[model samples]
Target chain A: MTHQQIRGVYSAATTPLNADNTPDLGLFTGHCQRLLKEGCHGVALLGTTGEANSFSSAERRQILEAALKSGLSGDQLMPGTGVAAIPETIELTRHALSVGVSRVVMLPPFYYKGVSDDGLFAAYAQIIETIADDRLRVVLYHIPQVSGVPLTLPLIGRLIKAFPHTVVGIKDSAGDFANMQALVTAFPGFSVLAGADPLLLPLIKAGGAGCITATSNLVADSLRIVYDHANDQARAADVEAAQVRINAYRSLSNSYVQIPTIKAMVGLKTGIASWARPRPPLMALSAAEHADLATKFAQLP
Target chain B: MTHQQIRGVYSAATTPLNADNTPDLGLFTGHCQRLLKEGCHGVALLGTTGEANSFSSAERRQILEAALKSGLSGDQLMPGTGVAAIPETIELTRHALSVGVSRVVMLPPFYYKGVSDDGLFAAYAQIIETIADDRLRVVLYHIPQVSGVPLTLPLIGRLIKAFPHTVVGIKDSAGDFANMQALVTAFPGFSVLAGADPLLLPLIKAGGAGCITATSNLVADSLRIVYDHANDQARAADVEAAQVRINAYRSLSNSYVQIPTIKAMVGLKTGIASWARPRPPLMALSAAEHADLATKFAQLP
Candidate 1:
């Protein structure tokens, strides 16, 4: 992987919220430490699974500060600093860079629908220029299904051409393997992290960076096993079979909401009831649903 | 209209950004004042047209404060208090209420896609409970095309049933006339503000409160004419004809991005170049496009 700064398995970790919906800083910091110990290369904090957009800019900055104060190293963190606002995005990105976190995954401004590629490019350009930090490394986030904004190949190429050093990698969360493969083929030597867990092995084998996925939150050690041995022919079948099982687990719970289901799984695994509660607009799994998921999760190979 | 707190044509005003992309408070206040003078009943600051989500929480609060200081009455202002975060939304809503702005338009938590109605209800419920303000009057914003979240009638009914006084109105920007009509029919006496200019006449005829439209930013006086006479059988044809012209203008410039084109029109009309520049992720219209729009705008009936 050419973009080694952001290679290997990363978890788009879940954000634990208090009863009043405030970020649980202590729990979040602990989760980061746990993710690192569970075999994740780094934790992609505030990514979709973390409910990044659901927190205010102040809260996000405070969470970052708390995480750092609690002994989480910048090298092991890549916070999702993207926002609908350019200045706010710059503020978060600058804060991340100023604190020694070099790489940040950013979503394009997503509030406006049917925005042009030029608009999207101008947004990234402004953030880059405004931050004006040479050390700033951006891993573009592409999850059009949710954001309603796609970072097409042409746009990605243009961004890279304009700022080759600053624009380092991309997390293709489109969940289309073909799109991920095309991104890998188009930007050879560029870090192409898969957003979906099932594609982790294929993406690693395709000369790409590892995955930054939500599933890695709970199964980082498992994902790292596949990532580490993706090139080993002897482990190829086993990795594929394990991926299928992981995919099955993902599919079963994903039939419900992803963030809440993942939270429920975390609660079930850790026996932390509060972990099952997602912020509003994302309901916690029902007792029955959690029981069913527990049975299915236990049944997974 | 039954909901007098938010009746009549309102401009979903454009947020004026300074050269550095900061909210130009003076410019915004001037625009609001001008809208009022031009026959707008009120100004809906920070709606989709106003690029509400594209600014940080602090910036949004500052803009609202400036608008108030500039002598815009809270009675005639409905600032959008919606954000992806529940606490932030509650904070903004509480600020609006505390400052005497009883009516505020709110968007559902839009970051999570395919969220259940229960989840959406939870979000509003939490906000209402947390805010705990009897004076707070919320006008739900349903711009599914942009927000990627719809406030279906059932959900709206649920919110109203839960908090009838707080959840007072809806701005249906789904761009679906049928949806707006359904909302109006389903919730008799509930305020239904048309989010599109073209639907203003029909919506008003169908018992909608009025339109809170982007076009009202520029053509408030004209829209007021249609809204004021929507039920007059003798003037029905005239109102429909005016709506057709408004729709034409919207359609023409919307062919080349709505917000930027409107901003360009404002610049052309006022000779303020900065008015045309949208915050990043929203590129300004090229000189050529501006010229074309100017010609089209002039030719409008």
Candidate 2:
């Protein structure tokens, strides 16, 4: 598929771990399949919401295999293949490509803070060179808030110039529309996916691609409505109305830790308690918080 | 070894990478050996200065094994075994223990930001419980500036209370002496190693353990003098004078990226240009910067 085809609502799907903390492959694949069926254009597995950094390389491969075997099409999946180590990133990215998965979102080596643009360029160049896979397509994951490493426009421009086909897209999770607008305006034809749900309508309206957001796991059908109606002059008000409600839902849970709150919402919807348990360093929502969330979610239109 | 013995000047040694960016095990082992022989009480391998996060698990294991095989005692070595993944952390920690290396400095699962103390506790508990080694000892690594995850005093208190024998010490790299003082005063008898060279005298004077500083790679012998004379009333003024000079050197190179600056300094000392090549995320010092550093280093008494 071309870069333009890689658009629309993509769920930053969370990985469901068993009580013992191993990836519940059955649950994970089932969730991805459900997200696809629920109007999500695709499922972005193993992104931050998926706890990608918290799982071993071997475990991540197993997850990909399980999702593929469960009938999820490679065309509808984008796995995060980034890690602090370059070799591991290459291993994950190469494996994804070898299995016919073309598009992968990668974070820069984030351990070092305040790295030079030259260093960041060298990192991407090294990965592209080392992988040596012409078929490999990279969506630069730019979430400086969490990663503490920003992929500045100059670095992105250089990478695109050097490897136009390989570096085709980016997921701008910086939560700043100006940055997203700058990116979308600067690279007209590039696939610029908003990482936040609230930016979906504005970003889509700004000659950009759709979103790959965490809330897509729960609200993909609603987000898809905004994406589908973003450009329709008659439906402009309807799109704005829908986006406001989505933003309200996002704001309601803004007080809680994002990943676990989303997981708890999923658990409430599915009646599966195990879905609520985020791996360590991401605490599960407290009993009181979960009950309150259920009440608030019920109140949402 | 008891927590008390885990003291004095420990170099947060830099990992020497070869021309191809792979860990130079020969050079790495040689560097560790040299640090121990040059007035360092012990060698702290795989800390930030060592670029531990940038190397793969297999590579780190190789480095540890090489150091041990090259006649370095486990008692004189403290490896940074923390990784974003809990299983990977356990594997590395268990490997260190099985090889008779007991004391380890571990960073929290740092990829996730704003994690709760409970969640942080859960992460550590899972690792300690999974490893299930009675001989396991941990020195919590708190460099919130770099890790973006702070190990608050409350969290430390809970961990120590829960795992008194297992959580033995901490290397507070917050760069705030007040925080270090709180840690030292709050937990009397706990090993609190300062992470900066300038804090070595004050930290040691405050009943804290000596430092595990990055600059020790180049100035271990001088740091040893401060550690040795911290309690000497007559030499207290003399120690302060020496510390001012060391602090000045640190300040001169503060404008450059830290890991590469130290790598460049080591290269200048050893006359090996290859030692100056940092991994991808860390750029090497510019020629002008290196020349300036050489001149400043020469001015040191």
Candidate 3:
């Protein structure tokens, strides 16, 4: 109850793309607004699920701005600003701050894996010091399976110790509940957000703040219910039902490559064909795959 | 050999840094010139050894331009321009072509691991097609251990078939000689460069085009000797002796973390401390480590 900075369910929102493979800003903005309307605490845009790393620096900046300019408040938006290059990370973070957004989810300088904790610390310290923005809040990203750069407990402790105010939370996406539980036990008053949908109820019960998950893009209502009532004895049944619905969505999404499938599901849920199109290096679902998914998706709770 | 396209010893040049960790453009250009003078065929700046991903897009462009401005010809420079983001990769590559540097080492879009071959193929095809420059000649980068994205043989075949002229060669930095040999066997007229120092002689013997190696940063003279005389029976002894020297340098570089140690050894070789200052996310060798390396470095053949 005491250890939460970023609370409740945030949608690890998927960005829609036009035929030309550029971010469909209007569609993207609408999705962000819908996530908020659907009970997401915030739109955590440009995360891994959002394919932030797949987009160029310019495109990332544009996507963030589109979200804010389309009437989402700075407080309701938490865009991912990290990239392989520290300078660009700085540039992106500064752009967010310049546009009145303060919170960002940042992956480490991920291109160089097997890097020493000293180097990783230096990278983050330099970024925070260089930015020198007191309003900034960074949720340290721990998606080692994807980024290939793990934020170990010691590293997270050091980052928290050094930049206590700025480094407020983390999104653990490794899908290991034991590891997530360990993170919660290790850090006090720091948010530990589940990066997976299935863990939302259990994590919230384990004193985690909430989640920023791809399933929230589809089942934000259920995720919100789970987050809000995880500790309530009377509401346990409702929360369980919500959790089941989320698991159903997550299961179907994982049937294909998670991110593209999630996007395809979002398109199905919204009836927006553009939602199905992903940028290169993350192929959009093939026609038959999408049709198959659509049929299965129709039977989801 | 008839299969070779880009044939020679190319140094995966270690970029020198200022005290602030910015690319010391003058020193970097100087190192490029010195690498060429030391008998390297060309300076392959901004590969992994160059910490290219650690640098911003603007910084990457500057590093490439600095080499050209300092009198290196287009044919004498092959910069690595691929990055996690497809558009940035395109931007960097297009910048290289715009500046008359046609040959560039390109890594596949690497953020999404376990990606489908179709997605990977679409990724490369999009970049190549979007660039659409006839002058462009891509040396596919296959460093799975580092980049987390391997340019598989099948993927390489697909790319080469699609853009036979543009996708001309590959730098197989996976350090897997079997993979390198397989690439050479499967693709005729495709240059297969060894990513490690020790493999140069054997790869050349097995029909690899040449090498783009970190050890070449310190032992370019030896690598060039091996590349030139690997197959000549009359020079076998000389090549063996040179490779032995290259191995000695590489061993000491690996005595600590390879990249920082290579930079430190480059400093030791050139009597320039600036070479030791890597950007954040790559720590410089400690003074004690440098002193120890210097002691052993002086004894190398």
- The lDDT leader among the candidates is 3
- Please report how far candidate 1 places residue B41 from its true position, in Å: 0.8
Provide the lowest-lDDT 10-residue window in model 1 chain B. B1-10
Q: What's the C-alpha lDDT at position B63 in model 3?
A: 90
Which residue runs does candidate 2 get wrong by more than 4 Å? A1-5, A234-241, B1-5, B234-241
True contacts kept of 2: 0.81
What tens digits encode model 3's per-residue C-alpha lDDT throughout B73-120? 999999999998888999999999999999999999888898878888
TM-score of 3: 0.98
Q: Which ten contiguous residues of candidate 3 chain B have the minimum total lDDT?
A: B1-10
TM-score of chain B, candidates 1 onward in order:
0.95, 0.96, 0.98
Model 1: residues with Cα > 4 Å off, grouped in runs? A1-3, A237-241, B1-4, B234-241
Instruction: For candidate 1, write residues A208-240 as lDDT tens digits.
Output: 799999887777878988998889989888777
Q: Name the runs in model 3 displaced over 4 angstroms.
A: A1-3, B1-3
- Every model's Cα RMSD, please? 1.9, 1.9, 1.1
Indicate the docking level reached by candidate 2: high
TM-score per model over all chains: 0.96, 0.97, 0.98
